[model samples]
Target: MSDQVVPAVINLDVPGPVISRHLYGHFAEHLGRCIYGGFYVGEDSEIPNEGGIRLDVVEALRALDIPNLRWPGGCFADEYHWMDGIGPKQDRPSMVNTHWGNVEENNHFGTHEFMALCELLGAEPYISGNVGSGTVREMSDWVEYLTRDGDSPMVRLRKQNGREEPWKIRFWGLGNEAWGCGGNMSAQQYAAEARRFGTYCRDHGGNKLYRIAAGANSADYAWTETLMKQLGELGCAYRPQPFMQALSFHYYTIPGTWQDKGDATVFDTDDYYRTLAKAAYVDELITGHANVMDCYDPGKHVGLVLDEWGTWWNVEPGTNPGFLYQQNTLRDALVASLHFDIFHRHADRLVMANIAQTVNVLQAMILTDPDTKALVLTPTYHVFEMNKGHQDAASLRVDLPAGVPARETLATVSLSASRKDGKVLVSLSNLDAGAPADVELDLRGGALSGVRARILTAGNLQDHNTPGAPDTIAPRAHDQVTATANGLRVHLPAHSFITVEGRLG
Candidate 1:
C-alpha cells in the first residue's frame, strides 16, 4: 500500500523571497553579433581583448556568477540615443540600428562601452531608457548623463566622454517594449510615460535610482492592469513619490506563432512537447501577472521585471533574418529549467529576471567567433552554471506531490528550493522525455548532511555546445542522490537538469 510518490516536502524554516542576486540576471542587446561581434572586439582586435572588451567574453561572463547586466536593449532600448554613444571613437555618431538588424549601429558599443561592460562584469547596470524616441528632456538628460555629481550640463558631457567618476547606475529601464517596440503606448499612454520618465530619474550623488516601468507583452493582463492603475495614480499625483520601482514583463518561448518560431536546430518528440508546453507558461504568466498586480498592488509594491525571457527559436540557418541567431538546445536547457523554477516560485512577486540574451542573441549564454576566436557555452549556459547556488538564497518552501504523474503531457518536475550559505539547495527539472523520476524529497526543518548531485544531460534532444564541439552538453558529477528514511532519494534523468546539494548543518 505504498506506491511512493510522496516525499516532495521541504521546509528549511519555510521562508521565501530572498532569491534575488538580481535573480541571476543578464541580457545584452543591440542584436546580431550581440554588440559588434559579441562583446565588442575592437581595441585593435586580437580576440582576447580587455579594453576593447571580450577578455574571452569577460571570462565567460565572470563564470556565470553574473548578477546583473541588462543594457542598450531589447528593441534596442527604444531606439537608444545617449548622445549617440558618448564622444570620440573617431567622433562617434553612428545610428540606424532601427530596431535590430536594420544594421549599422557603429556607435561602437556606446555609453562608455556599456559602462565599461558593467565594470568588467562585476555586474549590475540595468540601464534601458529612452522612452520611445526619447525626451522628457531626453530622459532628464539621461539622468544627468549617468548619475551626476555636479558641474551640470550632463556632468560636462560625462566629463567630455571620458568618464570622470559618477557612474553607480542602479537599475533604470523605464522604457523598453512600452507595449511593443516601446512606443505603441496605451496602458494610459504608458502610464503617462512612466510618470514622466519617473520624474527626472535622478537622485545622483550616492546613486538612488531603481525606477523600472514599461512592461507587458505575453498574457498582457490588460497591460498589467493599466500599468498598475496608471502607475498608482502617478504615485499619489506626484508629491515626493514619483515611484516606479519595477513593473517590466515579457515572456518568450513561442512554439507556434510569431511567424513559425519553431526550429532552432529542428525538433522532434512533438517539438519537445511543444517547447515544454510553451515553457510551462511561465508559471501561468507569473500567476496571471500576479493577479493583476494584486489589484493595483496589494502591498506587493511593484517589482516583477522579468525583463524579457528566453527561447524564441528560428533564425540560425543562414542568419540575418533579423539577427536573432539561435542554437542552444537540450531544449534550451529544459526551457531554462522551467524558468528558473518559475522564478524561484515567484520570489514574492518575482524581483528580477533577465535571460533573453547574454551573447549571440536569444537563449544565448555565450557563442562567439569574431572570425575564429571561437567559444561556446550553452545548454542554457549549463543551466545558469548549475543554478548558481540559487543566488541570494532563502526561498525554501517546496511541496509538489499530488500524485506525481504527468501534468498532461510533459512537466514531470520543475521544482525550486533554497536556503544558501548554510545549504539546502534542491532545483529539479525532469520534464519527462519519457520517465525517470524518483524524486522523493521531504527534507523538512533540518536533516541533510551531504547529499550533493549535479546534472545537465544530453544524449540528443538536439544536444548542443558547439565551438568545435564542446563538452557537447556539459555539467557532470551527479550522484543519484541518497539518504532516505523518508527523506532523500533521487534519480531524475531521462532528459535532465538536477541540482540537489544539501547541508543544514
Candidate 2:
C-alpha cells in the first residue's frame, strides 16, 4: 500500500450547526419488493413478522436510530390514494403499480400500516401526498384523518376505520417529481400547485405539519428559484406564514448513463472512482440550489430537504428489470460515507436527507430473502450504524491542511467530525483502491482521550454480503489508531470506512 500522510485538523471550538437527526432519515417506497417481501411479509408467513411487518428488518434498522421514514413512494406517492389503503385488509382494493414493476398492489400497507411501521421503529413519518392523479380535497382529508383529534368528519371516518385517536405526522411532501414522474408539469406550474396544496394541509390538534414542496430533479435550479420566489410572495404582507416550510430535490449517483447504469458488483477500478466522482457532484448540486435559496431567503428560514438520494445501478442478473434489486458492496459503503461528510458540512441550510430506500431497493440498508427468510445487513448499513453518532450532534470543523490527495477521478480521502454529550466522533473514508492513508488529526479546542474505533472493509471493492455469507463485509473493532501528543493518528485502509470515538475534555 502506498503511504500518503493526509494531515487534518478538527477544531472542537469551531462548532457549526447541530446536524439534524432527521438527516439520518430513510425512505420506503412501494417499488419492487421493497414493501411486499422486503419489509412486509404476510402476517401468516413464517418470517416471524409483527402484523405483516418484518421484525428482523425492524431490529436491523433500529441500530441505525432511523429518525424519519418517507412513505408511499418516489413515483408511487403521486398515484397513491390514501383512502384506499386505510380500511380492512381483506376489503382493500388492489391496483396496478404503474410507476414500478406494474405489479398488483393489494393496498394492505396503507396509512395505518405505515404508521404501525413508524411506531415499531420509533421513527417519525414523512408522508408524500398525491398530486398528479389526486385532488387537493383528497390530500387535505388525509392530513385531517391522520392528525385531527376533535369531533370532525375526518375524525369520524378514522373512528369508522377502527382507530379512535389520530396519529401524529409532522413531515409531508406536496408531490414527488413534479417536473417529470409526479405530473410532467413545468416548474412554474408546479409552484402554483404547491401553494394551493400547502394551504389546505392544516395543522390539526397538536400536530404541526412541515410541508415540503416537490423541488428540482437534479440540477434544475430554476425549479428551486421559482418555488422560493413564490414562497416569498405568499408571506409578503397579507400572509404571515409561508405556504411551504421546506423544498425537496432528488438526485441519484449513477456511474454511467441512466439507461446503462453500470452493474453494481461488476466494475473495474475506473468505474469505482467514476461512481465516487458522481456522488461527489451532489455537493455542487446542493451549493447551486442553496445559492438560489439564499438569495430569496437569506435568513435560511426555508429548509432544503434531499428526500430522495443514493446510488442507482443496473438490477442484478435474473431479477425483474422493474425491480431495482442491486447488490450493495464496499464501494457503496464509501459512497454513503462521502455523502454523509458532505451533508454534515452543509448542515446549516440542508436540514434533512433520506436515503433513496431502506430495504430491497436502490442502495438499501437491508436485503431480505422471501423464500429463506434470511436478512442481510448491507455494508452501507454498517456505515449508517457507525456514523449514527453524528445525528443531532454539534458539527465540528474538519480541515485538511494539505488537502485530500486525488485518486483517478476524485479525492481519495473524506473526513467529518461531530460532538455529542462529552464525546467526539471522527468519521473517515479512504476511497483509494490500493493505497492506505495516514491521517494525522490535530484535535484543537478540547482534549479528548479514551479512543475507540471500528472499521468496515473487505478484500475487494465488489465484495458484498449474500445470504450464504452475511457477515463477509461487516465492521470490526479497529486497532490501527494511535493517540498522538495533540490528538490521534489513524491508519485508514484502502476502500474502507472507519469511525473513531473519544471522550471530550
Candidate 3:
C-alpha cells in the first residue's frame, strides 16, 4: 500500500451557511419489513416495545440526534388513504400495499402511531400527502385533523379517536414521485395539481406547514424548470408565492444497471470504485437543479430537498425479491461519507436530505433478523454518529493543493469541516481500497488544540457486521493523529472513514 502525503487547507474564518440538522434526516416508508417487523412489532410480541414501537430501535436511532423523519412513502404515499389508518386497530380498514410486495397492510400503525414514534425519538415529523388517487378535500381534512384545534369537524373526529390536543407539524410533502408511481402525470399537469392541492392545505391554529412540491426524477432539469416557471407566474417581487415553500427530488446510487444492481457485500474492485463514482455524481445533480431554480427565484427563497437517496442493490438469496433487503459494508459507509461531504458544500440551496430508509431496507442503518429479533448496527450508522457534530454547525471551507492523487472513478480522499460550540470537526474518507493517505491539514484563520480522532474501518472492503458479530466494523479511537506546529497531521488507512475534533483557540 502506498502512503502519499496529501496537503489540504481549512479556513475557519470563511464560514458558509449553517449546515441544517435536517440534512441528516431519515426516511421510513411502508415497504418491505421497514414498518411491520422493523420499526413496529406488535405490543404483545416478545420484543421490548412501547405501544408497539420497538424500544431497542428507538434507543439506537436516538444516538444519531435524528432531526426529522419522512413517513408513509416513496411511492406508498399517493395510494394511501389517511382515514383508513385511524381509530382502533381492529376497526381500521386493511388495504393491499400495491407498491411494495403486494402484502396486506393492516393499517394499525397510522397517523397516531407515527406521531408517537416521532415523540419517542424527539424528531420532527415530515408527512407526505396523497394527490394521485385521493381528492383535494381529503388531503385538506387530514391536515386539519392533525394540526387544527377547537370545534371543527376534523378536530372533533380527532378527539373521538382519543387525541385531545393537536400535534405540531411543519414539513409536509405534496406528493411522492409525480412523474412515475405518484400519478404518471407530465410536469405541466402535476404543476397545476400542486397549485390546487396546496391551496387547501392551509395553516391551522398556530401550526404553519412547510409545503414541499414533488420535484423531478434524477437529472430531470426540464421538470424543475417547469415547476419554477409556474411558481414565478403565481407570485410578485414583493410577495413570495404561498402555494409551496420548497421542492424535492429523489436520487439513488447503483453501481450497475437498474435491473442488475451489484451485490452489496460481494463485489470486485471495479464494482467498488464504480459505486463511489456514482455516489460522487450526486454533486452534479444538485448543481443542475440549483441552476434551473436560480433562473426564476434568484433570491433563493425556495429550498431544494433530496427526500429519497441511498444505495440500492439486489436482494439476498432466499429473501423475498420485493423486500429490498441488502447488507451494508465498509463500501456503503464510504459512500455515505462522500454524500455528506457533498451535502455540506451545497448547504446554500440544499436544505434537507433523507436516506432511502432507516432500518431493514435499502442501505439501512440497522438490520434485524425476523426469527431471532436481534439488531445489527451497520457501518453507515457509525458515519452518522461520528458526523452528528456537524449538524447545524457553521461549515468551514476545505481546500486541496494541486498534485493530489486522483482517479477517474473518485478522488483518493474526501473531506469536510465545520465549526460548532467552540469546536471544529473535520471528517475525512480514504476511498482508495489498497492505498493509505497521510494528510497534513493546514488550519488557517484560527488556532486549534486538544485534537482527538475516531475511525471506522474493517479488514476487508466487503466486511460487514451480523447479529453474531455486531462489532466487526464499529468505530474506535484513532491514536495516529498528532498535533502539529501549524495544525494537525492524520494517517488514514485504506478504505476507512475518520473524524477529528478539536477545541477552537
Structural similarity to truth (TM-score) of each candidate: 0.35, 0.98, 0.98
The whole-model lDDT of each prediction reads 0.81, 0.91, 0.93
Report the C-alpha lDDT of model 3 over 1-505, residue by residue, as the tens digit.
5697998999987888889999999999999999999999989989999999999999999999999999998899999999999999999989999888899999999999999999999999999999998899999999999999888999999999999999999999999899999999999999999999999999998999999999999999999988888677433362347988899989999989999999998998989999999999999999999988887777788899999999999998888888899999999999999999999999989999999899999989999999789999999999999999999999998999767767774787999999999999999999988899999999999988888999999999999999989999999999999878878899999899999999988
Per lDDT, what order, best first? 3, 2, 1
Q: Which residue pairs show collisions in model 1?
A: 135-138, 178-182
State each candidate's clash count: 2, 0, 0
Worst 10 residues of 3 by lDDT: 231-240
Which 10 consecutive positions of candidate 2 have the poorest summed lDDT? 233-242
Residue 190 lDDT in candidate 2: 95
Writing each residue's lDDT as its tens digit, candidate 1 over 1-505 gives 2222435888887677788878789888888887788888889887778778888888888888898888888777888888877788777778888767688876877878888888888998998888888887887788778888879888888897778878888788888887778788778888887887788777777888889887888888888777777655433232224557778788888887888888887788888888888888888989999977776666776788888888888788877888888888888888888888888888888899998889988898888865667888888888898888888888887878666667475556768889877887788877777667777887766788867888988887887888789788898888778777857888777778988886886
Model 2 CA deviation exceeding 4 Å by range: 233-241
**Candidate 3's TM-score:** 0.98
The Cα error of candidate 3 at residue 167, in Å, is 0.9
